[model samples]
Target: MSLLLGVASLSACAQSPAPERANGGKGTTPATSADAPAVEAGTPDARALAAIRTINEEIKVDRIAAAPLPGFREVVVGGQVLYVSDDGRYLVQGTLYDVKDKKDLSQVGLSVVRRELLDTVPTKDRIIFAPPSPKYTVAVFTDVGCSYCRKLHQEIAEYNKQGIAVEYLAFPRMGVASEDFKKMEAVWCSQDRRKALTDAKNDRKVVAKQCKNPVRMQYEIGQRAGLTGTPMIITESGVQMPGYMPPEALRAALDKLAAEGEAGPGAAVAGGH
Candidate 1:
């Protein structure tokens, strides 16, 4: 169930074919133009599968369903959504917009996938800071080394006061081998995770410890979910609000979404800080 796709690199390959191993450096023969005709001779699904394999043989096809775009099939590779032509000759990566309805069809589709993925992480695996009776819950992908992540953590009390529960998921942008990952591991291993995380956010020295922890698993999950930055906030409804939002502003935005009865891609609100 690993969804860590290097789509960005794949997109780059589409423009200029990589000179390295055709099998993505896995020592296997890469698919070429000659392979296309044979793949096309098979079923559309087979052809689509072959086409994506040509891009990255390691790509895991999670789901394949009808796309919002006609004559295209939506393929969920890992957690990233891709639109493939019915003929399986074409592949699209990026936002698929519905101009008439003013919606991002790709994100709308991704929201569902995200929710499903997040649901797999049990409550015990998360580091939650919540009110006695929370009104809204947001899963925040955070890195302790990230400044904005620290800023957000500094206001954990405020967020809780606003009746918005913050459930933290580790996302060490520096990778698992980095010091930040070890720091997070120590935090999770601590007897009091909330206190440890707060102390780490404040740049306090945390006694390093190791134990069975979800830091690495959560980091991989974030990778699968196509997370590009820290402080990425995802609502219970799976709408992503990237960047940091102040306590009051965040509560207001949540209220606005609730009032409007919407939590789609269009409902996503961005904040500079």
Candidate 2:
């Protein structure tokens, strides 16, 4: 079922939009007039870009295109795919359904982008907890002060016992300058990091420690990856599971995702808060 849906989603992306030419040029050409701004290849015009920029200044518009229905531009905002009208009058936040195949094509596109963005964070910078024998590896962006994050930490052994290697990256949740950030830095800088993380997550104050750390960089990476909260999990295949999931549920999800070979948005099951 999912395989057919995946194929259809891929097809939709392939057929999205072609570059528009101005002044009868073979390719997109710059124009001085407001009505005839240069349209980038496979993207919308300057007018649409400006309109989208006005709505959400933070949204990094990668590409813009007219939707299947006219007057709307499918805007790829950072790694979170969304759609906006060409006139910037309306914005759609949910996934677009491909009725024929019962697939969420919008989610498929976002998953591809999310995976690419996750790869930008260097693996060497993370604090890894590897199982002696691993079956799955998941990268997690976590805040030291988040309750749900602490819960996930409590199950570290269970996850490892199930052959899932948990790699931790600092998310902070609070800005880099906050107390939570400092605590995370302490944990990362400790003589024994794994122990420090356990101690901190268990509500113990880690002895003040400092060193050159990648906490800030990890936070920035999370921002660029559209992570607004703590405990965001990313599987080896680039599937994102936001928030926390119980050990048993997480193991089952990992198994299913492994079997499927791909996961779209909302395919992940959440653990308790």
Candidate 3:
């Protein structure tokens, strides 16, 4: 069960420039003398690295190989996988849709990466909530003030009835110093956090509290996992559900994932798109 939250409040950070058409044509321009070395078929190691380096100076190429599709290369940088045209003329930052299978395999690949990252973090370091009977377990980074987060909290019973367990991690939308962060810290520090969280979500005053909490660590984990907002859900198989899902719909989606028998995370949901 993924919780949904608004990211409209968070300030946007600088990102890499979006890919653009250089020649305003259907095909790429012929390589000029100033261009990097040409990429040869079945041998993309050296030239691919050079091309990626030319495009982004900060990127450290981890691996470069032929992509599943023709005329493209898969470039792995610091564990993030992105596709680039053979000549480095185009770069794709979004998922690659498989028209034949009608699936988003790019998400599957990213799930493997997310799972690996999550595995490295200690589960004990997080604030957890378990269902009496568990069929699926999802980790979520949450902020109490987010309206969608409250909506998800209200549906907790429905999710549990569907055999989906919800686990909570701190991701105070307002960084460490904000009142929201302090309130979350109070929740984590409370002797009965479940009750405190419920109260806070309901707009009750959170008593001033402090403890050796893992809230900061969890925030860092969320960032490293590529979570940019509260309620970023991570499934047991490491697939990310970035927004909220109604109980019935979420159950059906989970059922579909099981039926498909895929070994990785499921496709991106409509809300996420």
Candidate 4:
């Protein structure tokens, strides 16, 4: 579900409020003061950019472009989608629906964006389970101790045998401050990360060690990609299959995804942090 709600109002294009009357109720002048010169759309565009700049600087807006709907524009902030108005006078925090398409357009946009984002991440940064030769690769956001995560791990051989390569990205499940996050750090920092990850999932000891790693960054990526639970699977094209599936069933899903091409080229739009 989308997190943005309600319309935000701004004073950018609206006429100035009428001054309070001496009598104290309120007064109204002509809605459009005849003397007001035609609004300089060029200058207002600059003002609109400046208005968007006022959003929390740390939020990291990567791209902003006109939305499918008139009077609104789409902005990619922290890899999530949002809509703002043309004159920067209103903001809508929700997904846009295409009544004719019968699909969630926001999810469509995000899937393409997610695939592009992951394409930039090198394989060395993720733990990969693969067969000698593989036909498909899937990315999963996992927590070491999550029950379903363990179940998926135990069936890794089954997946690989089916020509499904599983690449793991960390998601601590608990916030970064928790022990699980520390453990995740240890696993990533280990000289043999693949072995360490397997051991941790098998209920064995993970050698406690620390070093610079992408564990935290991966978790943040998962958050931005709309992950709400462990074992969230993402296919090569960024189709999110949330939850666990038996090896055969998962292969079937992957085959189905392979048969269908991308959602659409128009879905691919995003900016980086």
Candidate 5:
């Protein structure tokens, strides 16, 4: 039996691009039609071709393989995990649940990808709010004009107090060369990036300046990650949670995730964008 998992949308507080849906349920879904071949163990290059057919400038396909559950092939495209039938015709988008193991297997694959990609972002490109003894850290894709992003920044101290370090990655809602993008550049180029980020988030004036900044690179990264909203959170363990979260609630979620990481692997695969 194949199960269809439901994907929820964030409020106006956050939005995403045209990425496929993800399933998170107790039952595993079938990727292939009844007439198609069953899934077999394989690599991304082999399995990815089966589904996407061709990889070009667009339709980024990361990897593909037999899912943890039988009968389904796992495909990662546009930074999201989707499943395809062995024939590559049938496609399923949702978090895959391995009921036998009582685990969310889809998250396991995504978290791995997020961690690897996030590691590529340099510290010089980010504005960090860190605590001396941080229990956990979250990287946020933020826009100066985003209200939810502002709300999150307003509680920066509270989050720091909870041992949750917040790293600000410039993700102007507007695409490059727009006013929002320029404003972000000003903040990054400021003498004190931390203060400039705070001021900008608070609607204070940002002295216009120019310098090589990662504002564009961060936006591109966000796009690849299917980031369509502000205040998008990526935990240290690579669990992505979208939209605004109050400090206490954020802390609890981070704490629970950190504890689960200690359990290792599948235990930390529940959260994704």
Candidate 6:
């Protein structure tokens, strides 16, 4: 079960042609056929959970429920999901795809987790660029020094024009100890955050200053959210669109999600940059 023991605390730096859903979750839900055996409800027995804990004490078992596969339980650890046998002797760490429905069961659960975490962040902590009456809002994990992040910022106005509000959260692809992180801190500390961010993105020197800021907290949140790179976009419904998209394309994707309703997996856009 060591496979269930790890998680990299960490985007798409390159551009992907289409929108894609990041691996995520929706909580305990049945993923089997009508003829399948009835799934065991409630939490797994102590012995099973204990067996999993023995693999990694640092692994905090958040939730355990019946999985799509028989004799296995879906365990949510950190921001990722793992499928562990009811006996806890076997563990599987990968996406559970519903080939028939064309859905990612793993992402279904993680999406709820991601949405819960993202909701805790208040507007005061974000650098927002929005029209007076926006149609859609997206929170983006970004690094001031990242090229793709800069490209996204360059099109901020167009995104707003498309009725998309952009809220920026610092991720600084390099670890928090890097110079890029410092630049982000500077941007967050400036008197006019929007201008400071635009200036930094445009390669202009921002005044080096320090203050109590959300840059580090936001970066840590990004790490927990499974962000691998800068410019990772999270929709209002918790669907993630990795990489960069032009304003018009982004508006269209958001529109699709809106039309599909909450049950639709907005993540089907594009991936693999």
* lDDT tens digits, residue span 36-131, model 2: 224764444555677666765544554455654467666555445567676566666656776775656665544544565566566766777888
Highest lDDT, which number?
1
lDDT of 3 by residue, 140-234 (tens): 77888877788888888888888887788877766665688789889988888888888999999879788777676666555545565556777
The positional error of residue 53 in candidate 5, measured at the CA in angstroms, is 3.3
Candidate 6 global TM-score:
0.78
Count of backbone collisions within predicted model 2: 1
- Which stretches of candidate 2 lie above 4 Å from their native place? 1-48, 56-58, 62-73, 85-90, 98-102, 263-273
Q: Name the better of 3 and 4 by TM-score.
A: 4
TM-score quality measure for candidate 3: 0.69
Candidate 5 TM-score over all chains jointly: 0.78
| lDDT tens per residue, model 6, 93-158 | 887887886767776555655565676677998999999999988889887777778888888999
| Model 1 ranges off by over 4 Å | 1-46, 263-273
Each model's lDDT comes to: 0.69, 0.62, 0.61, 0.64, 0.67, 0.67
Candidate 6 colliding pairs, count: 16
Candidate 4 ranges beyond 4 A from true positions: 1-55, 263-273
Task: Score every model by TM-score.
Answer: 0.79, 0.70, 0.69, 0.72, 0.78, 0.78
Q: Residue 179 in model 2: shift from native, Å? A: 1.0
Models sorted by TM-score, best on top: 1, 5, 6, 4, 2, 3
Relative to the true structure, candidate 1 reaches a TM of 0.79
Query: Per-residue CA lDDT of candidate 5, range 60-138, in tens?
Result: 4544557775666776655577776665556677767767766677866667666655677878878999899887778
Q: Give model 4's TM-score versus the native structure.
A: 0.72
The weakest ten consecutive residues by lDDT in model 3 span 13-22
